[model samples]
Target: MSKLDEKVGKYIDAVKDTCGLEPDVDLLRKVTAACGPVIYQRDAETVASSDPDEMDRVKKNFLMKKLGLSESDKLDEGIEAAIETYGRSERTKYRAVFYYLLTKHFGKDAVYGS
Candidate 1:
């Protein structure tokens, strides 16, 4: 299998063991691939920003705009809340939410290694 497939397979297996449900692998791959550009853009923005708050804002804007959730008041507000709660040292909550959204749309087997 390709590297993307291998990573997706591992994710699928983990999801299966945790959720006890099979998910669509093809959809997962598509969503994962779609997320790549967003991740890259976020990384670039983070590198460009010297201030942590500025970096967080850039990341939030990217997430809101790219995810087509710009109008989501709850998500927008929640992101800020999460950032405050988690502080600048880590972003586990945000990452978890991002992965959750990806898996929700693409299934557990979405290929992301490529």
Candidate 2:
């Protein structure tokens, strides 16, 4: 597999193992593609849930802009729900998997053409 495809596979495994959910493989791959090259970088590959700036970026960039969601408390709640589902104790919360959870959580699978 290509590197991106390899990463997507890993993210898929993470969702199944860490989040206890059977992810839509095609949707996860598309979400991971949407994430771009950040997935290739070690530090940027994972999300720091404790960082406010990162959380804001996720809300603004991923949730609102990419997913075409409006600003609301539900957005924040969705982030929290993804974080909670990913396990707060888990340090390496892969961006693809996290975004996949958020997409699934908000019923935005249509955004990824799921």
lDDT of 2 by residue, 8-34 (tens): 889888988999999899999999999
| Candidate 2 stretches greater than 4 Å from native | none
Native-to-model Cα distance after best TM-score fit, residue 51 in candidate 2, in Å: 0.5
Q: List the residue pairs that clash in candidate 2.
A: none
Candidate 2 has what TM-score?
0.97
Candidate 1's clash total is: 4
Error of 1 at 112 (Å): 13
Task: Identify the candidate with maximal lDDT.
Answer: 2
Alpha carbon deviation, residue 3, candidate 1 (Å): 0.7
Model 1, span 1-114: residue lDDT tens: 875565456545544544344655665455445545443344431222235675465446544454444445555454454344334344322232334333354233323332
The number of clashing residue pairs in model 2 is: 0
58 in model 2: Cα distance from truth in Å? 0.5
